[model samples]
Target: MATSESANSVSQVPENCRAPNNPILKLAFKILCIIAVSRESLDHWKDTKNKDWKEHVSIMVNRFQNTNVTAGLVLATTTLFLSSPPPVEHLMAYNSTISYIIAMISFDAALLSVISGSAVLVIYETSTAHKDMETLKHMPRYQVIALLLWLAWPSICLSVATCFLFVAIFIACFGSDNIVVNIITILACVAFLSNGALTLYVFAVVGKKPANGKKNTPTQVIDMHHASIGAACLPR
Candidate 1:
């Protein structure tokens, strides 16, 4: 009976009186609440960023697959041509051996870079896919930058290989005495250079990402809506 009475007394305590009367206790409680809320917010932000990152990675994977296929084709063609024995006259021609060597080396390097980069990307994605976002959040800034640059290596290497291949072809053509080959090579080089310039402009200007990397977040959108409503309410 005494225990029952005590329980009843505790349950019947006034709501206002239930709270700690000590100022320090109240302040500490408030601080703890703030900390809990901040932690939740940080986790939520990380989750959102994780989703965005995964989406970006998926896009990169698709591009890498395409590049792999294209590189494989180029590599195969170069390997087949290089495997065959060249005629003695052609082998002895000025710059012919050097040009062939450069072309072979460049194509091999390009293929290797693409394959290695893609493998690293796949391994990273597989490892991180099931992991907590906290791990990624704590990753060093320089490491993240390095990973981004590594993702870009395949494209850069491929571009350099292609340019070298073209250089090799130009060298071979110019060394020949045939006027037809010379004229055709010159025209092709002009077109290739123009296309390269256009590609640079497109990549540098049109395809540039935003500096701040801020997308249309919910708070920003809500603020914009409120501002528009406020402007509408004001005198014209």
Candidate 2:
């Protein structure tokens, strides 16, 4: 009777309860799964950010190259014109107001083109992988590139403005009688003004972060609070 009662009691026990899984092992496995998932997510996020960084750097490099080319062309053309003088009868009076204005335009345009080309070359050199990695050790590479690009924009705009001014000066001095020249001069003036405005806007707006009415992130707030407490505890 005792053997039968023991067999009945054993049978009454739930299958799950009879051989339950180890709670500690189950918990450890769950934790490991969470960690693995977290790690994969972090890796994916890093890859995405790196891709974006590379794309941005490529765009900045292309823009710098284009600017440098434009500046070089302008500089070359100006140099050629200065090297070859026309017959005295065909040339405007060297001492005349128009001549002086032309001289000023040429000087300014050449100077701006040289400066812009040099700056763009420097930026390109600095943005190379080795240099960028070195710079990244101190600060984010993207921020460094962003700042350099911001500086380059003004130079680019100035170079363009110089080109427009060169055309306008030419039209004013030599093409005054032609209606087409008058229209072109007006267009050049408009382009110059637009370039100046864009430069100003870039300086004022592009790098600035938007001020959304939001509080600091939890991590930042906690860090700040801890810093404040630590400061308070320090001996004055």
Candidate 3:
């Protein structure tokens, strides 16, 4: 519990939920995923181990099967195209197409993960704080802010990637083999680089557990918690 509006003391917690070092880290990490890789797959991976996954076995099973099946299709199609040798087969020999498909599908899963993960984290916090829904809702609005960020950030990133891909596609359409349909290729690289950097920044700030419950001093910790769920932490 908050001991007072003091700096040295620590805030109280319930018995569950893992804490990170800096509260702001989660927010940064969330954004990084959007820019870095298939946000959907990452989120799906996390969802695989969550409570709902266990409770809703049929839904979870179907989702997993479908995802793998889609991935398999890309692989099978590529193999078929590559086994023969010819003018058409030369394009098939380049495996980047399959890689690109995988990346695109993965992005779908990643988006879902970003949304679900943020929700889970905020709900967990409310539970840990032992506050009711209304009380928790007013506390820091973690879920609300996360939802907003989830909407906007992807649009910005997608716009950049899509615009670039469009240019590349137009060039390829003109019979310039060099352009190619490599949307996934470009996206995969961008996602990995941008998100990886974001993850590192978050780790540096939060380290392991979130800051010792900053229930005092302008409520920095609480705001940080909002930031953790994928919102901007600073006023900027």
Candidate 4:
């Protein structure tokens, strides 16, 4: 007991004798942590060979969050107003049911986008990843478009649509209303086809990597700041 008291007093005394606090020191500590994290991330990119692949996925995680926010605010407003359908066939099986199911599917997509983006963005934003990309003029717009097209593709998800519930919703809404279903289906098909074609064009344009060490002029897509950090931290 005596030895323990002596040791505690000696060890604890140093802490008790320190100055009240220093704001500058606290800020410096915070900055140091940031720098260390940045350094780690920078090294990570340098080691990878598939720089474009990395960039592609990074942007993907990004768009998810962005589109999610937009969808939430815009679609939610639309849905609220849509509660009062036109005077004719309000709650009946045709238009109302079909439209409702489609609305639900759209809502579900927004949610999934948010979840996917938030999960990755959290890693990119909170961690040292930001440390590396402090400066970059532009990102390859073509690649970004390609990525968006890929993400939009339903084939990758394997099933007819995204998850099972999405498929069910699609089926529920698809055949209910002759006019509404036909119009919506045509619009959706056109959109999918157009976007897919655009993606293919981008790929053809960016057919091969530049032979020499050259990066094309970046066309800013999302946050230039975040993209810059990702680019910088990209390992050699």
Best-fitting candidate, scored by TM-score: 1
How do the predictions measure up, each by TM-score?
A: 0.58, 0.41, 0.26, 0.35
Candidate ranking under TM-score, highest first, comes to 1, 2, 4, 3
Model 1, position 154, has a per-residue lDDT of 64
Candidate 4 residue-wise lDDT, 1-236, digit = tens = 85797565444423322212577754543333222222111222222335753664465455545654654554464344345544334222323555566555555554554554455456545533544431111224344233323444322222211333333334444554567765775676677668879976875576466676455556543467678889999999
- The better candidate by TM-score, 2 or 3, is 2
Residue 19 lDDT (model 3): 25
- Give Cα-based local distance difference scores for all models: 0.60, 0.51, 0.41, 0.44
Off by over 4 Å in 2: 1-49, 85-123, 132-164, 167-171, 174-184, 187-236
Query: Model 3 — TM-score against the truth?
Result: 0.26
- Model 3, span 24-128: residue lDDT tens: 765555554443232411222223344653454344334334433443444343344334333453333232454344434334444444444444444444543
In model 3, the Cα lDDT at residue 64 comes to 38
Candidate with the larger TM-score of 1 and 3: 1
Writing each residue's lDDT as its tens digit, candidate 2 over 67-117 gives: 656666665655544554533423322334554455456656656756755
Q: Sorted on lDDT, highest at the top, how do the candidates line up?
A: 1, 2, 4, 3
Better candidate by lDDT, 2 or 3: 2
